[model samples]
Target: MSYELQALIGPAELVAVAAAEVPAARPRLLAQGLALIPATPEFLAAFRVGDEATAAPAAAVSPSGTAASAGFDWFPGGLERRLAAWSKAGPIACVEADYFGGTGTQRAAVWADGRLDLGPITSAELEPFPPEGSPISRALRRLGARVTEGDDAVRDEFDAVGLGAHRATVSWVSAG
Candidate 1:
């Protein structure tokens, strides 16, 4: 009944997250301003450009003209980033991820299908990135989600990385 967390390091095209370890610190990643999938290595690398994401929220890669033209909202309240990040590791979106019986814990494998089929990588070198922030909280606020209720904080921590805390109360399935 233990769940480990991990973060995929790659781009939307293809992603390979870091090794799954006993998650230590969970930092919320914001990608609204950036408009890129937070799951990709490129995006994570972009975030690596600086460690500010550790101190605050981090913006995801900005959606290109194509993704925008495709009617994709750059900031699906951070849903895109969350989806990409979770999918890379092969799990269901926590938001979409279900909690059974409304109590206890559940063990299962889940896979996520990120929304919006964005587009090819652009050479438009993302703007000079900035300090990071809590993308999860921001997205939650944007979506007007009641994250404060129940195990929302645990889910938020898990979304920041790839696994929820040990005390997340709610049940979560593994995306094996």
Candidate 2:
């Protein structure tokens, strides 16, 4: 399985967190404001963000969207990177996406204040965004901000934008 992730990070610290935590991978530039990071299955299995274990399941956004029933661990190295990079940015919003098991996709939107909305956009509603970008990239770009993917060496590239960092939070959901 392969998981592709796209995040709209708000607050500079959140971008730092994502940069630090997001597994090393090459991302594609979807537009001026969006980037897509693809991850290996092993990394996906170890992904976890703040308060995720205690987070409640979010409602399904589409027929295929479902709440996650179990907890998963974030890789130690990734988690440490996030903590180490915490800093200040203006308020920022993020959309974290994951795709696995063929057509299945899952998504969550994290707010700087620690609220998270989890689910996937309806496939029909996501037609304009190509596979190269994923639905989240399109949604983030629509906000009229600029986003880009960083290479392995510059994962914290988003932090340079001065957007405030969020108090990381995640709500897990599944979609097919």
Query: In terms of lDDT, which candidate is strongest?
Result: 2
lDDT of 1 at 52: 40
In model 2, how many backbone clashes occur? 19
Model 2, span 1-176: residue lDDT tens:
54444344333334444545555423333323433332334334344335453222322111122212111122222322232233222223334434445554434332222222332333332344455344343334333344445544322223323211221121111210
lDDT value for candidate 2? 0.33
lDDT of each: 0.29, 0.33
Off by over 4 Å in 2: 1-17, 22-30, 48-112, 117-120, 124-138, 141-176
lDDT (C-alpha) at residue 47 in model 1: 30
